[model samples]
Target chain A: MATPRPSGSGKRPTITEVARRAGVSTGTVSRHLNGGHWVSPDSAKAIARAIRETGYVANSTARRLRTGRSGTVAFVIDEPPASFFEDPTFESLVIEVGQALAARDQSMVLLLAGDEDSAKRAENFLLTSGVDGAVTASAQPQHHLFERIQAAGIPLVNVGSPAGLEDRVAFVAADDREGARMMARHLLERGARRLAVIAGPAHTPGGSLRPEAFADAVRDAGRTGGAGGTGAADGPEGADGSVAEGAAARIVTVRHGDYSERSGEDCAAEILAEHPDVEAIFAANDRMARGAIAALRAAGRAVPEDVLVGGFDDSAGAVAEDPPLTTVRQDFRRIAVELVDALGKQIDGGVRANVVVPVQLVVRDSTSPARP
Target chain B: MATPRPSGSGKRPTITEVARRAGVSTGTVSRHLNGGHWVSPDSAKAIARAIRETGYVANSTARRLRTGRSGTVAFVIDEPPASFFEDPTFESLVIEVGQALAARDQSMVLLLAGDEDSAKRAENFLLTSGVDGAVTASAQPQHHLFERIQAAGIPLVNVGSPAGLEDRVAFVAADDREGARMMARHLLERGARRLAVIAGPAHTPGGSLRPEAFADAVRDAGRTGGAGGTGAADGPEGADGSVAEGAAARIVTVRHGDYSERSGEDCAAEILAEHPDVEAIFAANDRMARGAIAALRAAGRAVPEDVLVGGFDDSAGAVAEDPPLTTVRQDFRRIAVELVDALGKQIDGGVRANVVVPVQLVVRDSTSPARP
Candidate 1:
């Protein structure tokens, strides 16, 4: 065997130096740095020792240039710019995802595709910007952004369940359905007979999944005799028969909102006007719940006294509410970790399935003394 | 000039094709694409025509590889992650900055350096990552992150005025001092004889400048006969001799907080406890103003009725308050635009000075009925 010789002096060692010290070609050293695939254990050990001895630090950017990978991922938000700031959940998710990416020596670029113009711009940037992959959040099922991303062949991971492209993309989502069921069961067990729901936009997965799951729980609890659930009553046939049956005994009205405080307040006002004896209100998210609380106070109803309000996404606002909020907690940190991991797998040419994180219900002053 | 020639058929045109048709070298074509500083106008026009004719599209990533420009900027936040979500001003700045960067076809990567470990990580990443530049927000004057960023030779533009580094770094900030003066004049003119200030952290530029300006306004108004202002009275050495002259007439007390709602509430409660007859309270920011409102309400004081409250930053919470906040609006959008522009200039090897955007006072329900 030829004795390994130092290639250069007074400069940082490159892959060529490591290869020369390891008695192998630079390609072998490059492959070793890129996960050591196809290299024998003996060669891998020699290369590792050579790297350690020669102080050869691999430049990730140079490696990316060689492999056509940017080592950067885009965290695309499919909401308006204002919503990016207004929603605490989005903030938490973005921070967690950025931190996670940072830990893996990767960078995350934030892209907002709120409207058609922005969507087109974001799509073009992603297609040609040399980003290795993407993690998207808040995309509606029918939004063409997903189709464009898919067509561009970029590795993708969704923060929430993708509506129609379930098979084509990987996702990580909190179990909104199970969380709604838990909220319903808790409320019902606390003797909340008359309930009202401030649902999110019908086009969103959380909007439909949360309300539908709550209705299912109510039906399973025998509160609404034969109404089946909102899912059944909302069918295209306009089936009012089951809804009429449950209309008299227990008032379970669902009003839709855009998951904003003002929208929640408006929906709550409408619900209160129509159903005067509503004992409990479930807002799809915390901001909406806060608005519901405000509306109740405006109408001379005290939270957890005359009415109990529950929220989802136990955000900072949840604790800051007057009576504090009884809400469901989605582990955003875990979801972010899973999202980065899934995207990493996809970047490595592996397919990943959907990941569902569990949710927990937190009881606070808003729903502690649920009255009959 | 050489006759223009068509290149390959049924394939993407390369730089060679454009160079051939333009009757120039490939180096000239690359230089033109990278911004034709040295190329003649006639040659530039020829290259442009050739590029259009040959449909030659430069690959941004490959160009970046050759030039070592990533076309990415990091928007770093020195505050904790929770603060990023809690403070509306931070959110607005971030959103506006992202939009401005998007317009320039640049990507923004958010980096949170709240803790020591994270700050170290951020410094390391910025030092090694191929990011073109950085725009940092919410960095305290004493934080060593600025030193590291400067030593690493990264072009930086701060969203707010940096203290000691003001001379060395470019920044964009609202006129906090002028805004505070306006608030003081407005309050004094409305007959708020007994005033209190909820000052921001003493170490920060806004913290020091806002309170000092308010004190200067009071001195200029001659409201506190010879006390100079809060800055003089609050300094060490018991300056009580001067304070005593104004203590019996116009009581102005200063309490400091970390620009948080909870801190504002605590400071306001302390102020109220010490001076029950205070007619006006000015919190450093909107969240603190909201907290002051809450504290007043808890003490059975109605805003603008029992006491008047004013805030800074005219954030989302200002309008959302029960009695809308009368506050100073720092035009975050303009500041973001200026920051991005400054960073771009710096990236082009141009030096820029600190930029100060103007502020406006928004009169609303909180202070319209200012009490005597």
Candidate 2:
């Protein structure tokens, strides 16, 4: 009778090869890699070395193909790294995006295009990873990868508006500026006199628009001032040095952050230091709003008591905070619903364009009549 | 020369067929699906119906694989339904897990197994989806699908103990009981005389082990009964309705929650109400600890002042809470590290088993000296 075939002999140098090279049993090689099994660190290191030299691919690809799935998607977000996971608003978006992807039998892969290096890595990963399509969220106009993504001609869906990308990429995004304007109008009606705005980074995509929209609403209401009162003239040497002044008091102060929660806290602290009598602080997103509340409390200023705080993005955590936040609610779920629907189209060979969702204001405990 | 291809004579049905059936313009159908293009709400509904009837598959599989990747890995977690996204600890773990998988040239496909139905769906998705491997974080044993995972022999790795699944699966877990015991010892040394333990659900795999470990440590320390008191065989069903003899005074009270922050608050409130002089509370996880702190403060109790508080799982958002948490630190990063390493091994056809990492106590503002 033929001798019992040794395991993995005719095939490639499997675990047995690594075991032999490390001068240990196959079980030892397995345990060393697993970490829970009682194996000496020395033995683990030897096995790792052997495996590296043997050049054995993990071979998950063969199994993956049996299910007929490419197994991944490109989740591209045009934002700073610090702000990616730090902002509750963005975090909620991520959760929703992830959930939507899961529902469609797809995986939502997060790609941070904060800087050039990360962007390059993200683009390379997207192109090579065998993702069916790309989901671009809040991309800036300056993102060089936009062109590359378009050129690759793979199905691409944009989550938010990228400056010039509306012409080429299909996308789904909330009407951000419209939401900001609505918030501004609410604050005005609530009699917010000394308004201070905490905006996101102006150089980035959404940053320039929110403040601009707020200014537009203020102007349309005949309240005087542009999106922000002072432009390039106010503090050209200050953080946002270039401010051309219009109506300064109605739009009293504008401070900028990279849209990170930590930055929100710092910005609030700075704004409070500069304008102690400020009554209403309108943060661009829920994360910044939460930070502002924390700062206000630390400074002994009560929320909606000494000051009425309003934010944008009705993140789930905002409702559970010490005081539930009052802010403009962007329908992220709806946006996601539309986004996936659009992605299905692009991959089905549809032309690229932008899809916009409406935004609304959600009132809660964080804002109130300026304490009589 | 070959006749020029007719403008609309493509192999696949043009956007026109989808639009014609749906009674909408080709542009509307195209925009509704490609993501970025704008479409009227009414048209969107029609297009969805048409696409469904057409049996349209995006064919992302073929197009994406052209670049040589399916780009996905399955992310598996065992959490309760409502607590899935509500619990920051679990949420952060998933994000980190996603990050790790992404780092390894893969994308994470999220699979939530919070209940029986969800678990079945997750198991189906795991098998059917072509994922590279599964990062199973289910803490509930006796899950029928665990056996399925074992039989299928995919690169399955559990984040918690694989209780009855030792032989068939591999896993990466933090030392839960060890961490609990260490915290118990710390509390005892700090002179937390009237101590109480607010544990997680008894049915949960982690919950059962933690309380047992705490009991062991208390016994080892010789701090079971009050210095001169006999074990209580006569109190009204102890605060949590769990029988407690007077002899178990030093480690007296015990209650349980489904492991929610809200439950933490409730447990603290009930225990304090029953035993007003109780000096310390040990919550099973950080979320519960946070709730307890909120409840304590609301009832005029100062954390670590009138009472000391500690928790398990140094989760995200814990350090950032009002008074930073003092708790047992279960290293999720290390867990992720071991998990990826183990998965890489299994994918290489190496038979690996369970791995355990050490747990340590993390001191924060929540715990302090008992009142003088």
Highest DockQ: which candidate? 1
lDDT of 2 by residue, A26-110 (tens): 8886544322146554664566456545532222222223222343456677665445555565666666776676676555555
- The top-ranked prediction according to TM-score is 1
lDDT of 1: 0.72
Over B184-287, each residue of candidate 1 has an lDDT whose tens digit, in order, gives 77765554657789988775655788888887787676655533334442321111112222332243699988888998899889999999878789888988
For candidate 2, write residues B1-372 as lDDT tens digits: 011122233233345666898898777754443331365545645664554344222322222222223345556666643456566666666656656765665545555565544454454444333344677775466445565454334467887766655566677778878988887766655555567788887654446677778767767655544422234232312232233343343666888977777888898899989998786788888888888999999999888766778888888776579788888888877787778778766765555767888998998777753332
Clashing pairs in 1: none
Candidate 1 per-residue C-alpha lDDT over A1-372 given as tens digits, one digit per residue, 9 for 90 to 100: 011122354344577777988899999977655434466657756775675455332233234435545456788888877887778888888789988987785666677777655655565455434467889988865446676565455678998777666787788989989999999877665556678999998766557889889877877766444333334322211111122223422446999999899999999999999988787898999999999999989999888877889999998755685898999999999999999988887787557768999999999988875322
TM-score of each: 0.69, 0.66
Instruction: Provide per-model DockQ scores.
Output: 0.10, 0.04
Model 2, position A193, has a per-residue lDDT of 53
